[model samples]
Target: MEAVILAGIARRVLDELLRNPYRTIELRSARNVMAVEAALREAMRLFLTYDPFEDVSTGTEGLLAELMEAKYLETRIPWEESDEREVTICRAKVKLVGLGRVVEVERRKGVMLARVRELFPHEMDIG
Candidate 1:
């Protein structure tokens, strides 16, 4: 089923995000970016991944709505005023589960990117 595939992709993204928390990654292509976004949406509802990053990554509740409204603003600067245009990475924010944090995601050159900015240590009982 499509839902199953989406859920799986979402879990993978969450795992990768926690695996290297706070790090911004530039995915291979736009398709990859869309995959991540779609997965986030699906994960918001059914968080099936709960490993590595610990308990906080429990696929939090109501994260989908936040991500849906999250601002997607960007500035573009073309390398040349021609058909071939190159611009800076596009940026946006999305509330992610597990860390219970809003991450900054970027897209450029048909690639996807995101940075897990903050993760409350208290949520993980770090202190």
Candidate 2:
């Protein structure tokens, strides 16, 4: 039996093209090759349900690998010891994890850049 699927239908049609003389064939038949056209309609219904973009809206192939593993270099403060505020610098690039997307939030002081996700390896040099 050969099953050929037609257009716009999820079901298939079976046809017996060959006849056997020495063997008795009732419900059991053999098919060489069959084409599935209507099966696409049903398969598409399942694919569209769960897509890769459910979490991430966009994903670019290459983005310079901006974030990397690094260590906090130092903290720079402008005020005096009594009421001093500190700034932070990392040794190398920082690692970004669990971030669906990467986008530059803002830049400060021309040299200071902040990212959307928090820096990993939590314990970093702080002043």
Candidate 3:
């Protein structure tokens, strides 16, 4: 299911960001930031491509929603470029429409700031 894949990707991104040496940095030039964006885009591509028959567990939707709320991953309409939209990941469902177009999955900025504040409050003054 897309939600499972997305949750996995979000967890990986968070782990990578936390492990990176420049986790405290705010600049986009940081390798971790670029990698996070690239990973998100790739996950979008995967979402657009894959159609599996496995059923998702009831708990996955909650997990995905939590990740989205935490700003780990986001879904949006590509052309409108508006704020994040609500996306429901259906299990074993085929995407009949919009197969030719791309879905936008973005890495949100709040994750880093919130993570830093939670994990390294004393280091906040150093940045």
Q: lDDT order of candidates, best first?
A: 1, 3, 2
Q: How much lDDT does each candidate structure score?
A: 0.33, 0.20, 0.25
**Which candidate do you rate higher for TM-score, 1 or 3?**
1
Most accurate candidate by TM-score: 1
Which of the numbered candidates is closest to the native, going by highest lDDT? 1
Off by over 4 Å in 3: 1-29, 44-127
For candidate 2, write residues 72-106 as lDDT tens digits: 33455766773646544423221212111222322
Residues 16-119 of candidate 1 have per-residue lDDT tens digits of 55554322333323453454455455542212222221222223211121232222234455556666444233232333344323243343443332333334
TM-scores of the models, in the order given: 0.28, 0.19, 0.16
Tell me the alpha-carbon RMSD of every candidate: 12.1, 31.6, 18.7
Summarize candidate 3's per-residue lDDT along 50-122 as a digit string, tens digits.
Answer: 2111322221121111121112323355665656454322222111111121122233432111111011233
Off by over 4 Å in 2: 1-62, 66-69, 79-84, 93-127
Worst 10 residues of 3 by lDDT: 110-119
Ranking by TM-score: 1, 2, 3
Candidate achieving higher TM-score, 2 or 3: 2
For residue 18, model 3's alpha carbon misses the true position, in angstroms, by 12
* 74 Cα displacement, candidate 1 (Å): 2.9
